[model samples]
Target: MSNKILIVDEDSKIRKVARVYLEKEGYDVLSAENGVRALKEVCESEISLILIDVKIFTMNWIEACLKIRKNNVIPIIFMFNEIENINAVQVLPSVMGDYIKKPFNSEELIEIVKLRIKRYKISPSYQKLDKINIEIGSLTINRDTRQVFIANNTVRLTQKEFDILELLASNKGIVFSIEKIYEKIWGDVFFESDNTVMVHIRKIREKIEEEPENPRYIRTVWGVGYRI
Candidate 1:
């Protein structure tokens, strides 16, 4: 199937220009005037990536991204007119793939789009799962859907967070160190000083655990690692 990219922007000229450039590279382009329209489009269609404007008038870009992330993990790129000191940080890494400043170079835009989509495709979470739920008390993790729920209410987790949770939950009794967790989830070399896994674990606890200070589900193994 051809890769389809959704561009959400209020400016008709910007959409038209993006479509022209993207179509030349054989990417099917879809355009939405606002975040509401973008949300509707995402639900109705299968999109590989999204290019959204930072200055959305009808709806907030972060809100739009969170809504999309409810069911889809499609890569999202934010567009900015100019960098006003670390503008990219405004777009959350969990919901955002990357950002390109307005009046962006066609090569840069295309490269960013290509890289984000590629990364999403190769991500372990994007691959096939058993379509089963692993239950741990009130928490329910659906592997296939990549969703977490407490009782009946859904809990939002970043892709990495979910992956880490699922890894421990699936194994149940196994203990995975921070290095192992990082290497397994990230598929990369783990630096001795890196606290990436620890940080994500803390974030996951904040969202899922009632009292992050004294967590109930995920238990720290003191000097070793964490377990569910």
Candidate 2:
């Protein structure tokens, strides 16, 4: 998978901060101080995702985004300081994948970068699941469509929830530590304070388990992690 991220911003500080954190997380980080350089980088290299500031010094940021999206569906995330500025560039959600406010936390920036890159990596046409259908007790997991069904009824799950469940279901009977699960899904370093995975597990159990306290499909190995 291409783990390249192109960061476009006028401020050198922004680029430096992003490059430092992203490279530390194992991404091939590239940066541009202006739109011309940014476009040239995209044309010359395989960029997995883009993080662009809505405000740029050399060119209109919105026009830059439009030009980039003209031929590529690579994920693009907007960065801006003010909420009003974000609203100004409210183009089709299809063109813009996500946004992050400036002065963002290092952890939050890393998390978003990992998520966007991970989603881009798992293209339906390119990536294949180990198993298409996973059955555990009354639960049914459809890997192709990323859906879960229980007793012939659909169990809706958030993207993260589905990811955690799919990971466990496909590799049934193998206990995965919290660090492993977080790294596999988030594509970034895992910290103990990051309860994002834990929360998603709880939510998945609530939707799929008859008793979340004592999950049937997803069994928690005490002080270890979880398994199916």
Best by TM-score: 1
Please state the error at residue 199 of candidate 2 in Å: 61
Residue-level lDDT of model 2, residues 1-228, one tens digit each, is 326789999899999999898888888788999888988777655567889887752335556667767655578888899888766556555456688998987899989988887786676522433246576776777676666778545788988888898899888899999999999999999988998888889888889889899878889899999999
Cα RMSDs, all models: 15.8, 17.2
Error of 2 at 216 (Å): 51
**Which ten-residue region of model 1 has the weakest summed lDDT?**
124-133
Q: What is the C-alpha lDDT of each candidate?
A: 0.80, 0.79
User: Mind sharing the TM-score for model 1?
Assistant: 0.52
Q: lDDT tens digits, residues 1-55, model 1?
A: 4577999989999999899999999988899998788877775555779898877
lDDT of candidate model 1 versus the reference: 0.80
Report model 2's TM-score to 2 decimal places.
0.51
Backbone clash pairs for candidate 1 read none
